[model samples]
Target: MRFTTIGAAIVDIVVARVRPVLGAKQDVDHIGLYAGGGAVNAALNMAALGGEVSIHACVGRDLEGGLIRDLLQRHHVRADIPDHTLPTGKSVVMVDESGAARAYAQRGASAWVGEQGFQGLDQADVVYVTGLSLKSQAWLEQALSSMETPTFRLVVTPGARQLSHPQALEGLWKRADLLCVNASEAARLCDESVPDADAVSVEAAESLARKLVRRPGQHVLVTLGAAGAVFFDGAQECFHAARPVTAVSTIGAGDAFASTFVHAWALGDSAQNALARATDSAAGIVQVIPANRAGLLRKL
Candidate 1:
């Protein structure tokens, strides 16, 4: 299965340590930098899992962006990065001892990849659009409309902020083949408050999925953190169990899960198998120190 992921490709400076100070005396124990972002991570995972994947994004003409491009190329992911003058997008991720993270993001050159960047998407079998990339409504709409192939599947993950403007994305959502989101994003789409770590929220998630499935050609998949994931395919409901693992960081787990699931599904795996593989892949990722290792699943 060949896929193209359209979104930001960021240089992530991840600090995986806990310190006492909040503002001034904050001390980090370990700092690791890698090429990362939702789409980048997903595309890398898909490629690592033996799927043909390409990344379509923008990067700055700088050392950091060059390194990121080289890393993606090393993983055999087709890097379709446009040259830009702005610094490459980057994230400062601080993960506490408990694996929770606080991130500060700078969307530099990534935000500049406008409609022209979507010029050659007709060759892809599937296009996964991250919410971060959809921040530019005009560019996203233009890209979606530019698809020349009718068989190209569209998968949309309406990240956190994009859900606030449902009307802006409703048309695209109606055209999407799959819609993936977390419980909070699902709740926001459904105009409900999702409870933290609660079992009852699955119903809310399912409710949101139902509404999304009502849209033509759309299915919904909601990731429920440690509890696992739920999929609504318009006819039935499927739930997958989360793997039990000691997480070092949960930074890119969701992106890994989404890509793995999509990859498995594209390979003709059963829904249960796809979900299981995705959960296992993501669980393995969180336990690893680097958090974005492509071969992390080999350990499982």
Candidate 2:
């Protein structure tokens, strides 16, 4: 599949063996810099799965931007990054001994990508919009309107930013061919019946997905890490159970699932089969550290 992704491209600085405690001096285990961001990760995953992928995002003319470009080229994914005044986006990630990570993000140049990114949207088989890119709400609305004929598939995956803006997200949700989100994101987007955002039941996920499906043919997916993922169309509901695996890190597990699901479904797999494929792909992702690395998820 030929895929075009619109979203953030960030450089992640990871420091392992750091405690969340305020002021405690401890020896660090390791430190590394890697390519990250929702769109960047998704693009890398798509390329790893043998899909022809291209990314539209902005980055500054700096060392970080050079690194991002290098990573994309190494993976055979085409990148369309315009020069910006602000430095490239970055995240300071602190990983505790237990493998849980806390990140502080600076959007920087990622917030703007200009109108050039939308020029050849109809030419690609799939155009996946990640939540971080939704920061350009006005531009996104305009782009969606211009593609009214729906010549290509549209898949949306919401992040914290998109979920915070109900009206904008609702507008995009109505037009999306496939809307994918993790269980926690689904809980936040759903009604008050879902009190806990971290732990959402399959029934609640399905209900939440059902409510979000505005059109007859739209598909909504709620992914439950480790447990499984729930798929809901206007008329059908399907759940795929996850396989057990020892996880090294789960930072980009959802991205893996979303990319794989879209890739599989777009290639004519049944919804249930696609969900199973996605589940297996996510299982592979969690087993690797620095989850955003390209080539981590191969065809299973």
Ten-residue stretch with the least lDDT total in model 2: 291-300
Candidate 1 lDDT for residue 115: 39
lDDT of 2 by residue, 1-300 (tens): 799888889887777667656655766776777888888988999898889999988889898898889889999989988878899998887777666667899989988864454677777899898866554755876877876686888898877888877677888788889999877777677645444333677887788888778798999988877778899877889988889887766667888889989999888889889998888888887776665756321121
Alpha-carbon lDDT of model 2: 0.80
Could you tell me the TM-score of candidate 1?
0.92
Quick one: how many clashes does candidate 1 have? 0
Over 4 Å off, model 2:
20-24, 115-117, 133-135, 193-198, 295-300
Residue-by-residue lDDT tens digits, candidate 1, 156-258: 8875556878777787777789999887777767777766533535666677778767465467889889988888888877888798888888888888899
Give me the displacement of residue 50 in model 2, in angstroms.
1.1
Report the Cα lDDT for residue 177, model 1: 90
CA RMSD per model (angstroms):
3.5, 3.6
Cα deviation at 82, candidate 2, in Å, is 0.8
Candidate 1 pairs with clashing backbones = none
